[model samples]
Target: MVVAIGLEGSANKLGVGIVKDGEVLSNCRRTYITPPGEGFLPKETAQHHRKHILPLIKEALEVAKMEPQDIDLICYTKGPGMGAPLVSVAVVARTIAQLWNKPIVGVNHCIGHIEMGRAITKCDNPTVLYVSGGNTQVIAYACNRYRIFGETIDIAVGNCLDRFARLVNLSNDPSPGYNIEQAALKGKKLLPLPYSVKGMDVSFSGILSHIEEKGRPLLKSGEYTVEDLCFSLQETVFAMLVETTERAMAHTGSQEVLLVGGVACNVRLQEMMAQMVKERGGIVYATDERYCIDNGAMIAQAGALLYASTGQPTPWDETYIRQRYRTDEVEVTWR
Candidate 1:
């Protein structure tokens, strides 16, 4: 059985996990929390990762009842994240690898999420809707790659929500997106927001601008409530996402839909996708925060798969990080 330790700190979350043969033995994370109306800075986030990574590593190993020498491989998210945070995690991963004399591999963060989603849900070849603070894409397996069927032309869906939350001074604890989702639950009115979807791609910057310029002023003037804004934002953005996902499914003939990412934990989004899939006589698969949100287990899972297939680790000098590693750029050899 392959035993791997995964490190992930692509954004504000610093996670460490131990996995054996696709099973997660330990998954622990520490999120960097900022004040309301303030977003996480890349440098600050990197510092947070540096401060907590060692403790998290020790906690993970302890929880798994393993030692550094027991680990056969070390895997870390190589990119498509903030450069500083990615580098911070990479430094720790490299040090661990050298200290333990274990093999090391760099895994794509997006592919890690997709792989972990499939593993946890047992859904094979599902059309995936990946939504997070940094990305938004509709993906499906084709030609040995996680091909992007649709994507955001501007800001990602989660980023849109996060910026809106800041506009409304939402708490950063837990997550601003989660707080928005909760506020949306109490919504009684659906305010109008721009619905911008150009063919296979969607644009959220316009919507975010509109909300901030129009919605917030109205909210300040007592013409609308935060719940109304939250409700309208979720409704409009989620509808666009579902529309694109449906089109992709129809095009790809995929009967299963998989939701993966930090934002994938949204119940309303899941419910919307489920309703659409149900109409098509298909099913939707999702996981809790442990698997849906950023975590180390996913990196470990994807890295372990690649390592098991190749039986090789990247040369130590070739482990440079990629800040813009696209999902389609990764060759799906394990699949």
Candidate 2:
């Protein structure tokens, strides 16, 4: 079996995971959380990863009961993430590869999530809805690539939630998005919010502006609670996502919908998707934070697949970070 160590620090989370072939032996990570009403910056995020990556790597190896020598391969997220944080993790993976004399491969962060989701849920050839702090896309496998069906025109869905959380002074400890999801649960009223979906693409900037500009009055005048605003936001945005995904499903004639990414952990979104899928007599698959959110195990899983297929390592010179790596760029040879 191929033993691999995966490194991921694409954004605020620094994760290290060890996997033997397709089995995950250890998954360890540290999230860089900012104070309430604050968002993490690239410099600080990279610093956080640098501070914790070594310890997490040690912890992961210890938990896996393995040594660097036992690791047959080292894998890391090559990107579609913050430049500083991506470079920081890449530096560590490169150093370890040289020190351990192990083969190394650079994996795309999005494919990492997709591959891990497929593995954990055992859902084959399902349409993917990827929602995260940095990205929002509806995708499907076609022509040896993860083809994007639709995507955000401006800010991502998670960014919309995170910024909204900041506006309302929500805690970013666990995550601003999680806090928003919690606040939305007690909502009793459906306040008005903009619904901007142009064909398959979505736009959240206008909705965010409307809430920030108009919804504040309702909150201040005691007409609407934070819960109400959050609930409305979630309902409106999730409806758009579901609509676009359904369109893609109809076009592709696929019966399964797989939700992957950090926001995939949201119960409301999953419930909404499940409801829609059930109506169409299809299934919806999702995973909790371990696999849903950014983690190194995914990188390891995807990397191991690539390595197993090619029997080769990514060259040291070509292991550069592509901060804006698109999901459709990587050719899916493993499939």
Candidate 3:
């Protein structure tokens, strides 16, 4: 039985997963909430990783009924994330690899999300809509690579959500997205908001700002409910995603759509995407919380497949963080 242990300390999350032959046995994650005064601090994220990574790994192994020595391969997220967090995970993975005398593979965080979506939804040849705090892209598998059909020209969708949440003072508990979703549920009015889409690319900064400026006054004056603002925001953003995804599907001739990343967990977004795909007689696949959001299981899934096919490992010295790593930069070694 071949076993793999995956580690992920990419952004503010520390994750560990144990898998065997593509089956995820245990996946553990810890989220680090950035304090109000201190913005996304890399050093703090790394500190959180240092504190939680080992325990999470151990817990995953225990849940999987395996030991560190039982792992045939070790995998860690490599780049497209915060530098310090990546380094923290890489260090732990390297240490484990050296201790167990196992080969370690560095996995791309975006591809990890894609592969995990595939694993959970069992979708083949689907156009992927990946939206997170750091990324918002429409990807499709074609000609041995995942092609980026569309992406944000500036900020990401989740970033917009977080920013809007902060504007409304909704970041005290849960997640911004979650809080927004809850607020949207009680929404009663559809406030006009900017909807910007340039060719295949989309921009949310303007819309976010518009919401803050136009809706804030109404929210303050008790003219519009917070729910209404949240509803409108979700509608505008989800519409942009649906529009871009539909365009990508048509261009790529893909009939299946897979929604991945943290934002994929949004029930409203999922519903909207599913409705859009169904209207076109296409299928939409989405993972549950386990794989929808960032986690180590997906890293292990992608890394194990890459390792099996290539027998190559990213050199420790060569590993580095890429705040903007294109999906096409790395060839898909495993289909």
Candidate 4:
């Protein structure tokens, strides 16, 4: 068995996965909440990665019943994430690759999510909707690349949720999305909010501002509950996503939709997407927490495919973190 170890510390989460022959043996992650409450601080996140990544990697390796020396390859996320966090993971991965004398491959974070969704769902040629704190995009495979059919013009969908949660002093533990989802379940009112969609791209900045403005006045007057605001926010944002994704599928002539990213784990979002797709005689594939959120398994899955097909192992000298890498910039070598 050709074993591969993967590391992902691109955001606040530290993940490690072990895979052999395209099958995941173990995948583990340790999530870190921001200290200042909302939004990630690059320097702080890097420190967290430095402190927690080693233990998580060790735990994953032990769970897989393998050592660093037993691995044939080491894979790490290289771009489309915060620079400090990405650099932290890259430094560790390079050190391991050098120490173990193993080949290293740097994988795109977004592609890792898509590839992992494919692996988990066995969905071939599905139109991908990638929604996260840093990104919101509609992707489809065509020609030799995964094309971005549409994306957010301003802030990401998950970012909107986190920001809104922080605005109302929601729980700072775990993730704001979870807190928002929980609050939404208890909510009774549906507050009207803005919905912006242009051609294929979507925008949430206006909606976020509107929610804050409306909710603040109501809270000050004691006329509305926070739960209602949370519920309204999820409903509006998720509805926009459903509409745009459906439009993208129609344009691309795709019968399958794959939801991948940290926000994809939201049950409400999944239900909305699944219902919409089912109505159109299409299928929706949603991953659980393992692949939905950032994890090392997806990195290994994507890297192994790239390595096997391209026969190009990443050089330690060329390994660097890219904060603003675009999904369209990468050419997909694996189908």
In candidate 4, how many Å is residue 224 off? 1.6
**Residue pairs with backbone overlap in model 2:** none
lDDT of 4 by residue, 114-225 (tens): 9889988999899999999899999999887989989999999989998998899887577899889999999998888887988888999999989888889998887779
Best by lDDT: 2
TM-scores of the candidates are: 0.99, 0.99, 0.96, 0.97
Write down the TM-score for model 1. 0.99
Over all chains combined, what TM-score does candidate 3 have? 0.96
RMSD of each: 0.8, 0.7, 1.5, 1.3
lDDT of all predictions: 0.94, 0.94, 0.86, 0.90
Order the candidates by lDDT, highest first.
2, 1, 4, 3
Tens digit of per-residue lDDT, candidate 3, span 1-335: 55778898888878999878879999999988854323467998899899998789889988999877788888888878888988888888888888888888888889999988888788889999999988999999877788899999989999898888877777635467888999999998999888899999999999988997898689889989878999999999999999999999999888999999888999999999989999999999988778877899988998888888787877767655565567777789777
Candidate 1 colliding pairs: none
Q: How many backbone clashes does candidate 1 have?
A: 0
- Runs of candidate 2 with Cα error greater than 4 angstroms are none
- How many times do residue backbones clash in model 2? 0
Indicate the residue-level lDDT of 151 in model 4. Answer: 96
Q: What would the per-residue lDDT of candidate 2 be over residues 194-229, giving only the tens digit for each residue?
A: 899999999999999999998888999999999999
Between candidates 2 and 3, which one is better according to TM-score? 2
